[model samples]
Target: MFEFAWPWAFALLPLPWLIALIAGKQKHHSTLMLRIHALAHMGMTNTKVTPSRKWPHWLLAIVWALVVASAANPVFRGEPITLSEPGRDIMLAVDLSGSMREQDMAYQGRFVDRLSVVKAVLSEFISQRRGDQLGLILFADTAFLQTPLTRDVDTVAQMLEESQIGLVGRATAIGDALGLSVKRFNEKSQSNKVVILLTDGQNTAGNLKPEEALILAKDAGVKVYTVGVGADGRNQGGLFSMLGSSGAMLDESLLKTIAEQTGGQYFRATDTQSLANIYKELDALEPQAEQEQTFRPVDALFYLPLSGALLMLFLAALWRQLKQQAVVGDA
Candidate 1:
């Protein structure tokens, strides 16, 4: 549909006519008629004052009308769009403690760090989450929100990929991570609020205890799915493998408790495949509706009329200048 953004501008369409009417009245009142004998005595010919050409005045009126039309801001609106309500608000809390550097997880038959495997799998998971608000939280000695709950999954994925071990600190703050997730969920009024926490070790730092965080999560009605990521074998032999070495220390009891307390499930991911499978299960549990959304596309048309008006004015001015030059040359 085509319409004017400021239709009120059309009210000024009579402005030129009003100005002409007032100017005519002023001219009539200011008129000074002299007798023909007085003019002959002054050696003046009986010359009549010829009225100015009306074409220029008419052209000016047209230009003014065009200018007013442009000022009305004409636009072409496509169609109205309706958007469906979002499915879920999922917050991802990943462990960035020093232990996450352990390389027990396999990717493409090659050993990779725990964090790398998480990033690769999580990126795919994020891509699949259409119409869901996703958030990212990185935790080490403390927890902090990397990205707020948003529908921009690509941004959350980028932030996850950019995260490095020990970015916050070397110790795991599981309680703080859960607490922060719960706090964030409370801020939104979404019906389905979820938190997926991936960590490799027990909580060694933070103000709140894991149990206390679980209480808050329950109160907020936020579901928390916890994943304990590491290799199973006690004697795994990778150059960076900390599983058989001193780095393997997962608090499965606490993780399972948090998940169960919040009416969520606990998953153990020993390799990249398992982690991917865990996220797949999550997708099944919280399936997104196939419904669609719509919105109108608008294109501004003010420039069209505005440009036409400017061009007409320029041509009118050029014509007047040329006519004046011709008169002067003839004289």
Candidate 2:
């Protein structure tokens, strides 16, 4: 729809018409005349010729109308739009043990270690996420924060890339990882916080037990999705160097119990493909509702009317100049 922002300016449109009427009605002085007495008695021929030019006032009035219309500032109305979405905050707990280096899981038709496939697929996963706050926790024997809960996924991914096994030693502390993740979630309410824990081995170090950490998560109202990652027996070759053979073992039962206690489901990722699928499924889960937001930018349209006024003024000026030249030639 079209509308004028300054509709009051339209009232000025009639001013030029009133001025033209007054100017046209003004009286001009009579020219000097001399007459002889005998000429009054003679017969005379009379012919009527109608005047072709009465007024050019309408041209000037139209120019003024254009100027006023231009000043009114017209704009097009925009349509309303609707969008629906859920809101939630998520924290990802990743295991950085040396055993994660085992090359037994198949991904994209090739075999890569649990961590290698995870890093690749999860990086893509993080990129696609929107409107969710995310954080990262890396654990070995001890737990360390790769990043705190944040809305910036790129920072989280960069921290994930920098994670290595030896930062907290070669031991697997599932409890400490959960505890740290829960501690980070403490900053937010339980209903809004969630944890996705991925590990390849049972807990070996940490003050808290798996059940105890789950209790903390339950009290906080934070949901926990536990993912146990590793292949079956003999996947780790005898020639393994950086990671010992013991790293390949996964405590699935403990992970299940933790998830169940926190009102979340546990998942087993025996291969990289299954791990990727599990994360994708988690992405589909709905989050809590958040406050809605909107923004609008205004655009000025005064130039359109101003251009028309300019053209009208130019035409009037040209017509006046041509009339003046013609009068001069006739004289």
Candidate 3:
């Protein structure tokens, strides 16, 4: 719909008319009389009087109307737009300790490190969270919030993929990762707050303990899904298998406790496929909302009327100039 933003401008419509009336009165009062005898001597009595050329009064009135309309600031309001409100605020915490450098996880028949496999699978997972705000946390000796909770999942995913082992330090800070996630969740009012914490080793560094972080999560009403990433079965052909040694030691019990205490579940990801499956399960658990909220959009249309007023003024000036030139030529 069209509407004036400043309807008060209409009150100035009679200003030009008032000015013209006052000027006419002043001209009439100042009229020079008295020179009948002088005019007869100068041949003014029989001289042909040339009528003064004037522009149509209605044309001036149209210009005034255009200027008034432009001052009113017209606008066109568009229809309301509906947007889907996100159903969940999810934070992804990945371990970047030295242990993540171990090449125990396999991706497409090739051996890859735990961090590499996590990035490959988690990137896809992050993309699938269409209606959920995602954040990233990287932990080693200390945990750091890589990205804040945001609707731009692509940026979060890119940060996740760019993460490298030992970026923070060589020791795993599982507790710190959870603590940071909980702290971020406390800032938002969303009811469905979730954290997906993936780690390969136990907590060897950090100020807060796992139990303390779990308590904080429970108090903040944040659900945490924990995953212990490592090798599943015995290595059949690797050098570690020849020496009868297993891969890195993962603290599964602590992870399970954290998840269970926060009303979430625990999953073990020994390979890329299992990690992908875990994220798929998470997607099923936290679904996007069906109903969406809406808002109206408005666009200003003042420029359209203002441009018309300017164009008309230009044409009027050109017409007046051409008429004056024609009169001069005839004279």
Candidate 4:
């Protein structure tokens, strides 16, 4: 549909005529180079006013109308699009600690780093989130809001994809990640706040402790689904307390407790398939709202009339110049 954003601008259509009427009348006095009536005709040159051309005035009127039409901001609006309004506000905190560089997660039968696999699966998940405000937090020694909570899922996905291991530091700050996520959610008014924190290790480095962050999450009413990501054989020993080499890295107990306390769930993603499945489960849990929301795509058409007006003015000016040249040649 075609419409005007500023229809009132059409009232300016008569402005040119008003200005012409007000300024049109002027006193013209010819110089009297005579001593008296006897010498009045002695080499007296009278100034002659050229007759105004009708075409120029008519052309200008048309230009004024076009300019006014342009000022009215003509727009072409496309058909209305009904979409489900975003109800869920999901925050994704992916571990960017050095351990995330571990090639334990499998993709297409080949072993890839945990971060790569997570990016692949999570980007797909983010793309599928049609009507959800998504945020991203990349955490290592601390958590950074890579992308704010926004309906632009592509940006969130791109941030996740561009993340590098140890971009911040070399230690997993799970507590800091959780705390930041909760803090962000509390700043918003949305009731459906969710945080998906994926980590291959426990709270190794950060100011906030995992327990403290868990309490914060619960208090803030933020649902946190913790995913313990890594290959099973590589991580062994204790689920609660610290154990052998890199074995104690994946703290399943702490993750489970965090999820349960915050009325969320914990999943152990031993491989890529399980990681994707975990997200699928989350989809089933917090499905996108099915209610109706709509918007119309609009395109500005003011430029069309505006450019036409400019071109018309240029052509009129050229034509007037050519006509003047022809008259001079005839003279």
The candidate scoring highest on TM-score is 3
Clashing pairs in 1: 81-294
Candidate 3 weakest ten by summed lDDT: 239-248
lDDT of each: 0.85, 0.74, 0.83, 0.84
**Model 1 ranges with Cα > 4 A deviation:** 6-57, 79-87, 150-152, 187-192, 234-249, 289-293
| Lowest-sum lDDT 10-residue window in model 2 | 29-38
Residue 252 of model 4, lDDT score: 93
Alpha-carbon TM-score of each model against the true structure: 0.78, 0.62, 0.81, 0.67
Clashes of 2: 1
Model 2 residue 281 lDDT? 80
Worst 10 residues of 4 by lDDT: 26-35
Answer with 1 or 3, whichever has the higher TM-score.
3
- Show where candidate 4 strays beyond 4 Å: 4-73, 81-87, 96-107, 110-120, 130-133, 140-172, 187-191, 230-250, 290-293, 300-331
Model 4 lDDT per residue over 105-127, tens place: 66988877778999999999999
Q: What is the C-alpha RMSD of each candidate to the true structure, in Å?
A: 4.2, 9.6, 4.3, 5.9
Each prediction's number of clashing residue pairs: 1, 1, 0, 0
lDDT of 3 by residue, 176-270 (tens): 99999999989987558899999877888999999899889999999999998889534445544343333446778898998988889999998
Q: Where does candidate 1 have its weakest 10-residue lDDT segment?
A: 238-247
